[model samples]
Target: MFSLYALAQQAPSIDLIISNCKVINMADGSITQGQSVAIKNGKIIDVHSDKYIKNKYQAAQYIQAEGRYVMPGLWDMHMHFGGGDSTLHENKNFLALYLAHGVTSIRDMAADISKSVVKWRDEINNDQLTGPRIFTSGPKLEGYKPIWKGVLQVGTPEEVESALDSLQKLNVDFVKITENTLKPDIYLYALKAVKARGLRSSAHIPSSLTLNEVIDAGLNSVEHLGYAYNAGIPKAATASKASQFNAEYAKQQYRYMANHHVFITPTLLGSYIISHLDEDSHTNDAYLKYIGRGIKNTYSWRVDRAKNISAEASKQRHENYDNVSKILPLLQSEGVKIMAGTDAGYLNSFVYPGIGIHQELALMVKAGLSPLQALQASVVNSPAFLGLTEYGSVAKDKRADLILLDQNPIENIEATQKIHSVIVKGVVFDRRQLDKFLKDVADQNVSGL
Candidate 1:
């Protein structure tokens, strides 16, 4: 007969254990203290009281949380990886930045670097690369002679079908259609086609299409707040008059969106940065050290464009951002889901990757969401929208993508920035390792690698 000590010594061994932590339940923002999480094979095998867990299992690696707060790793649902081949290496460097900032997953909303992005996505899943879980739309669909350099230009119904076929072949996470140069009719048709194929779709609604029309046509998400705001006003309204928030029309739009189960990725950080560029150029920003020369070079165009704007134009930009941001609370009240995303990548000016998602969360709180609501946008709503059932919680069977914070993010959204450690696929990255990720990227940037 095996003695008690012998049985304890033979307890099942797991990959890692995070003990004595407060686990934040993203489902409803509840906290369970004195908990221990056991992870094995990249999945949370069990979560129990620290005493119970310690007696029940042995782990190869252990993290003594020391009363820290633990939550699911964040997701940046709307970012990009573009700026052409020359910036590919610089863009690839963003992966480490995301992991360093406790972002374990990201959605690339279509960019010029689809091929590399797709390859990286698969490689990361297979443990061949180190980075956030990538969900990419691959190359987006556009019209003939589209302004974007990398796209599958389709003007006909048959072409749209073919474009979608290609996307399926690449096994993209979803379909992203933009309004830049795509015709309104084709855009509507593409949305319907994507829906018929049971593929999720997100888009920049065309000016010619009403918000109601796009929702009815099967657009799963509205990419930015400006698009939804524009839907509430008259098409004839000028840019200067776009700031007028129409309560009744917006209410109807919100209801329509909620009823259809559509999501909104406000990407507020990018707009906020651009709107306030006249005040802070971000040239002396400390985050610049981690960005490659090629990526930093891409920020010039947006900065120069903002510089030439008249004082009145700058004022209008600020007012527009403020007005549109106010609708976020209303959207939540009306039952619409918000996904926190920082349109952070090449050509978006100063919105830095990795850390940008934290800034986005703070902005969401400033725009009237509670800290929990903001947290849900990144960790909960984002994965649900992507149909990633295995993520978004620190529970049994959930993916072991988590972050240990120095403070409670539910109490203060900014607490996310105080990450003590990050775990991606059961591999723990302690403070030292996370800092090394940042330092390595910075060194690569300085060396022009």
Candidate 2:
């Protein structure tokens, strides 16, 4: 019985419904057919067959995904956003860049506009602006006589306490610690302080501490795969002169962290850009415009590093990538959670903001992750790590943070970006909208240049 009345049977009209899309069920590697996702207000209301939804609820708006692959919006876990402080409107512009690229949440590892970024983070949560949701660590912690900008310098235990106190007052989400910037004791102390306060701690693991020590001390996450790369070695050198000899030992040490359930962000996009900065490149990458002039110029320094790296250094650099590939499957098999991060910001050199994430997915695939596994590293694993309960998976009750791909991502990960449309917060953005946004970003950057 064709009941038009049944179509309006549902009382509360859904705000949006995405129909006829192939849902990428991350829970298991299977694709589901003919499913529709319905949303009301800002939350997902239902997921079911198109016929069932049509018979049950009326939607204010309906988006036809037209045979596209639908999966969760991605998270770039370690993007630095500090360079925006040099200008008046750069931070605001940076937010726009992130949203335009389907990056729904970003972990600002450290940024200079500590208070300003916090203000924006709150504002975004309150829907004050159209920007990606933020989790920030405010200023990085340094030991003393710090070289980097916007650091909380600590010399003694008291200084560490003072820094943590200041960070809490500033409403920092977590703490990001650096090696050269912090003494080994103070570094470990900061990690403990953050843990004692019930906040998560993530950082660039120092060579001073064993990977085993950092995990034992309650570090929540490792910033980059360099930590894992170093862990794979057999004999880690403590001195600068011996530094060259111990990389293999570092790789050897990673199995220990994997055994202990330590999660790591490889941030391979940043590695790829810096590693091959001289390899003929792509400019006007659609994401470049949203970057402010100061940070945009910072990218040139990457080329210098690439050119200056001796042949010996370059060979070893590639070997690090190889080491990463060798251990990734093992890490995954052992249930060591791996999250994807781009480290996509000024300090990263060649990595661009929005565009770098796709590059990162590719590198993860290159480094021994199955295409589906690589995609999950970028999409599913990240939100889970951040504790976004209703995000990441393409299922009922999840936020409508999803990308519509032209091809099956499970078969070919690069197909993940072949966007047919984007459904975020239940708002539909078609290819046309995406193209326009990217063009606007590029034109703005070119004008500034």
Candidate 3:
């Protein structure tokens, strides 16, 4: 029942109010303290010293931010929510879970179920859901055959044309193309078609395509760092002709991406677990409580498989993860627009959806990204890359997608876990409220009684 119109009437009409925040404005490299932020409806109406705002405007409800660092609620760009129907039901709870953890928006990278997600997107805009804003590819585009269910399979040039046309009719948020599942030629054709329809195209870069081919085809964005690595290989130009997924051949793809202006997500944590999962027991993970039971059973098979791999091969994967860690800083220095996305899902085992992102940020920090820079990867940088002008920053006229933390995240990125409050779509939830929501979910999910 709470929409922007309903919330605005109760908005701050008062002059100066206090939020007592340690602020991180990733926009201008500004970090300040004891400041107050003002709100009008769901947009940040003003942000000034408490006294100044108090004397200037009349307010209705004053949020006592008290010793908190107020920053933008996060946007996780690389999320997916379906392999089958059970996930569609779970998607409703998924939104609340993200919001509970301060994620205000999510870009789904193609779920098998499209109808519910699209409906969820519209309903969230209409204030019908209490979760993050959903932006989705709806379904993935593959070639020759639909290796996964709910895909828009394009086998030839005409099929590519038809799929592109269907995207428009379905009115999806973006386009997601996978590599191994499709032929590069027709996939490129589909990318061109996406552009012609005025939609942004992003994909798991086919190792076969050179970085130049991707940029030349006008790819809107590339999804992961591994893909960028392939593009770095000079012979990737020839790989497209032969259609091979040889990472070693495309080793220096980062340089090509930097030169040609392509973006990479580098969902390191998800990759970290997937590639090196055999290293740790899922039951022993620090954040295991955050994983729901339904999802935890799915993780056992992978962990069991990890136990059989040679210790030497396992050691090599750890080494690869360590090497991959360096890409975060390298991309930053090369002027690559890196956005934080967690390929966190049921299939990805151990990388729980909500908490895995915090782990991802910590890994990025270990790899030399400043805490400020890492926050930008999740917040300001993500919306900027997605061209979402209204939601990322905590500024006047920006949507009220803000999170208040007990500690300054710039000082320690893990301070993100000390969440105190979150304001999503103008509805505010303090720590107690969030705790209750999570508890109720846990009880209902576990007991169903």
TM-score of each: 0.97, 0.90, 0.89
Whole-model lDDT, model 3: 0.74
Candidate 3: residue 306 Cα off by (Å): 3.8
Error of 2 at 199 (Å): 0.5
Identify the superior model by lDDT, candidate 1 or candidate 2.
Answer: 1
lDDT of 2 by residue, 361-404 (tens): 88888778888788777777777766668886877788877777
TM-score attained by model 3: 0.89
Model 1: lDDT of residue 247: 71
The TM-score ranking, best first, is: 1, 2, 3
Clashing residue pairs, candidate 1? none
Lowest-lDDT window of 10 residues in candidate 2?
240-249
Off by more than 4 A, model 2: 1-10, 236-260, 281-290
Candidate 3 lDDT, 349-415, residue by residue in tens: 7776677678888888988999988888899778876677886676788877888888878889999
